[model samples]
Target chain A: MPPRSAPDRLLAVLDAFDHDHPALTLTDISRRAGLPLTTAHRLVGALTAWGALERDPSGVYHVGLRLWEVSALAPRGLALRQAALPFLEDLYEATHENVQLAVRDGAEVVYIEWISGRSAVGVRIRVGARWPLHATGVGLALLAHTDPEFQAAYCTGPLPAFTAHTVTDPALLRRMLAEVRRTGCAVSVRQITDDALSVAAPVRGAGGAVAAAVSVVVPADGIQVPALIPAVRLAARGISRRLGWRPA
Target chain B: MPPRSAPDRLLAVLDAFDHDHPALTLTDISRRAGLPLTTAHRLVGALTAWGALERDPSGVYHVGLRLWEVSALAPRGLALRQAALPFLEDLYEATHENVQLAVRDGAEVVYIEWISGRSAVGVRIRVGARWPLHATGVGLALLAHTDPEFQAAYCTGPLPAFTAHTVTDPALLRRMLAEVRRTGCAVSVRQITDDALSVAAPVRGAGGAVAAAVSVVVPADGIQVPALIPAVRLAARGISRRLGWRPA
Candidate 1:
């Protein structure tokens, strides 16, 4: 492949930072970005000066406040979270469980918001975390409502499994997707983590498209999936309404 | 000055996107970033390919969700807001006012979290918005408790006035800072906008440093400054405690 350009190289340095490797040294960034040491140092200096990255006392580089501020403007990220937060708070107060707000990103789900209940469950999905679509309740809820062609394409993929209960079989996942569309809610039963189960519903934007998903995770054994469905659906509707989606 | 390097130029492209300029065309990006058209096109192509910038239907480029996900990990931004949100919600519920959580950035305060009650005062400060140290409740609360040297230096500067009521005298500002220190909160009366008044308190981190500030904006008239003081202080203390702070 041809050598990357200036912007690609700088962005590659940023790409080197991820969920598992949020903090990195110059050498780490250089190696991960496939750039020479001098080039990495120059790019890092520019980024640090611009406040896209911050250097700690230990010389490890972490994302900075300026980048965070700019990123907050992402419509699907903080804007959606800002719109959904009040409803999410009400849901949390009503049911003290892990309340998560996520949006679909390709074959994965990107968690934009997570409200931790006083009593949280085992599956601690942090904000900005990504999980495969077939393995998460929020993912299935979003994927179910997505374009039929897109959904079919997703179901045709090699679905990875986290546990025995995960919908790794393409045929089974297609059936589950049909059920989700039929019922307007998704129940991911003990797939993400063995001890936890989740109920999720799609949140629609004013444009009537599936903009996001809201889910509540609880302990899997003796799970009240039926009872949780209404609450999850209500939260989804509440968020949808907040986003200007009116059921006429 | 020496010609800016490729990395610096690339960062300038990102810097061109801010609160004022959330969307940009290739031409706009090139002009604002001070790069040649050809250079800008090449860089934008790479950035769009890397998923840092998403091209919209109108051919405008926006900050992408992938970058937002990474930026969410910033400790002083989304992470702090995540920790402080519940208390902020409770405060909003209690007062039916605009509640805010902000952290100091340089000499300014950047609001990281905001919740507006339906009937709250018309003081609309968006998340990621920055305000000067002398003009807002969160700003005053943060500035008041900073190192004494820093406080004096700030107070000595030219205090810009929004109205005749705003504290323009350095001596008066110094006195107000003392009162804020004594009371564990800062009540900025009609500082930013004439009809708005705000009460703010310092939020401490695990090490008990003033890491953030919580504030509520209410109408200037019929203001219960004394009454709101305790509520705001309690909310701030609650968030600080959650962050693992314990008063000595």
Candidate 2:
């Protein structure tokens, strides 16, 4: 890559920290950020003083509270999660299943909130976890609502299957999206995990555009999809109303 | 103000967004960050490209999902809250009141997680909200656990009163801290609000140092503080154990 701009260089320092590398030493930051040791030192110092990064007594740097505070202002992040929590809680109360709220980021769905039910089927999802647009119930709900061009491209593009049950054929996946749009919900069984099945619905924003998706995941065996659909759609609609959406 | 370095200028653009001003225009960013308009434009563009800031259809810039995803890695932010959520849920279930988890930042307590009961007393607190060390149950629990010299300095400092029942006198505050230390929990009545009572207990980390506090807020009238203490302390201890704390 060509030489990055000053702001990009600073951002590179932050980008160096992610899910697998939440904590790092100065040397690690220098190498990961592609900066010299001295440049990394100076930028790290600036970030530390500004509270974007914090250094522990062990000399490892971690993301800081101030950065988290600022990010809490993200409308797509905590704000949406806060508005949807009560409904999510209600969904969990009604179904005793793993409840989730997620939004589309490009071709992927990013989970913003999750409330696990102790006795529910085990899920491979957590807050900040991501899944491709075709692999999860929330992902299917969100993908079904995207613009036609994007939806077409995504359907025709590479679809990685997580299990034998996952739909990898473009024609079949397109039909699934259509069914989701028609029925107002998506149900995926044993796609991400063998025992888990999820039912999800799209949440609308003020502009009546799909802003997020709400889902409840349970054991694939011995569960009724029809019984789960109403509760999932109700929670999604409740969250949509909370986000300022009104029906025509 | 003195001229800032390249990284500082970049960080200032992010610092411009907060609870009150979550979205901003270029001019607003320039004014709030105290940077030249051209410099602000450049920095904002870089941030937007890096997914740190997002611009809407109407030209307003808001904090973005990428920033939120990264902030989730913060040990004191979502990571801590994630570990404590199950215990908090149990606390809410048992007490049917508002449950909260907070960590001290300077002399104030910053709420990291909150679960509100539908019929619970109205609380002014929200996630990422802050309150003085002497004005909240979580704050008192945290303050009582701090080192003696720092705790003494904080006790002697000006105590801002939120209601007539708030303990503003240094001597009284000291006694309250002593009581909290002896009881292993803090009971603060009408300190931050006129109609609520809170019982909080400090949560310890792997090293057995106080890392956070868990609390339950309920209607102040006709409630038994003794009943709430065990649940609150139990939730705190449960969270501490999840954080790798072990009792000798």
Candidate 3:
């Protein structure tokens, strides 16, 4: 492959920021973006002037509001989350659990909205956090509804395990995907953390394709998983309906 | 001014998108960003490849999830919203009104979070939406706490009026700001919409500087504005405490 162009290098500077690194100094940006300090300084100045990055009083760089304003237009981010929030709130009100709305991106699920319930089980998930497609309820719901050809390719991957119950084997993962499709819902039990279980259902867009997923996470011990399935399914369907989807 | 650099031109391609123009074709982007078609195409290609922009099957471009994921780190956007969400939820439950959290950006207030209350007054505001600093409750709360010099300059001119009640006169606006500071809250009545009224309070950061404002909008007619003040102030204080602010 050829070397990255100037725009590509500039974008890499942004990509250097993530859940783990929300704020950084110019030196950190240079090292993480693999650009020279002088180049990074010049680029950071440009971004700050354009309102894409903010330099705080302490001289730490942070993602800025202008970028957030632009990113709010992302259909799978704030737009999708906006359409799904009312339904998620309903689900939260109904179950008083950790309600989440997520969309699949590549081999991972990115949570776009999270509504914590006052009496809900404790879960570590937050907005913009990503988890493996095979280890999350929303991920399974999304992956199950995707094309079978893509699913087959994904199943052959080196699936990482988080706990003893996480399905890592390709064949077992395939069975799990099939089950998710058959049941029209997905239950991820202690896949992410041993104390949590999530029930999720696929949300469809106007074209009848899966656009997102809604889920409810609860404590694993003595949880009534079956009781939560209908609520999650209802929330997902409500959001899908709001998105202009109709059951075929 | 000297000609904008190549980096500025590239950033202008992104600046072309806003709440009104979330989706654009190549021609539209080229015209809006003030770039020739070929230059726009090259920059768009780079942005598309870097996942900052995504092209739809119909050839329209949109801000992409990768950009959204990065922008989610914005301290004044998703991070602050996430921190204040529980308090916002509590406020919503307490009043069943249109609850919002906003931060000032130059002469405008950008709403970072909004919770639509069932059976409450209708509000035009949404998450990531902006309004002038003199035209809304949260805006006034934020402007009231800003530096005196900045506030004087902002109050001087170009205070656009949205409704007849909007405080457009600089002297009156200054007096209103003083009242907001004295009362520790702001009330905007029939400013944005003739039928709506909002009660807002300032939220302080760890350094005891006002960082954001919380508000609740309700129907203006036959409403007890005094009754809503305490609830909005309590929510603001709760969020401020969460941000590590302690009253002297």
What is each model's TM-score for chain A?
A: 0.96, 0.97, 0.96
Q: By summed lDDT, which 10 consecutive residues of candidate 1 chain A come out lowest?
A: A115-124
Could you give candidate 3's per-residue lDDT for residues B100-181 as a string of tens digits? 9999999999999898866988888988888999999999999999999999999996999888998889999999999999
Tens digits of per-residue lDDT, candidate 2, B66-136, equal 99999999999999988998899888889889999999989999999999988999999988899998999
Model 3, A167-218: lDDT tens digits are: 8889988998899999999999999889999999999999999999999999
Candidate 1 chain B superposition, TM-score? 0.95
lDDT tens readout by residue for model 2, A166-222: 888999999999999999999988989888889999999999999999999988895
CAPRI category for model 1 = medium
Instruction: Using lDDT, give the best candidate's number.
Output: 2
Which parts of model 2 are misplaced by more than 4 Å? none
Could you arrange the candidates by DockQ from highest to lowest? 2, 3, 1
lDDT of each: 0.88, 0.93, 0.91
Worst 10 residues of 2 chain A by lDDT: A216-225
How would you encode candidate 1's per-residue C-alpha lDDT over A1-248 as one tens digit per residue?
Answer: 57876787888888888878888999999999899999999889989998889898899999889889888777788888989988888888888889999999888999998887767776858888889999999999999988889888898988988888888888999999999999999999889788999999999999798999999999888557888899999999999999999996
Using DockQ as the measure, which candidate wins? 2
Clashes of each: 0, 0, 0
**Model 1: residues with Cα > 4 Å off, grouped in runs:** A246-248
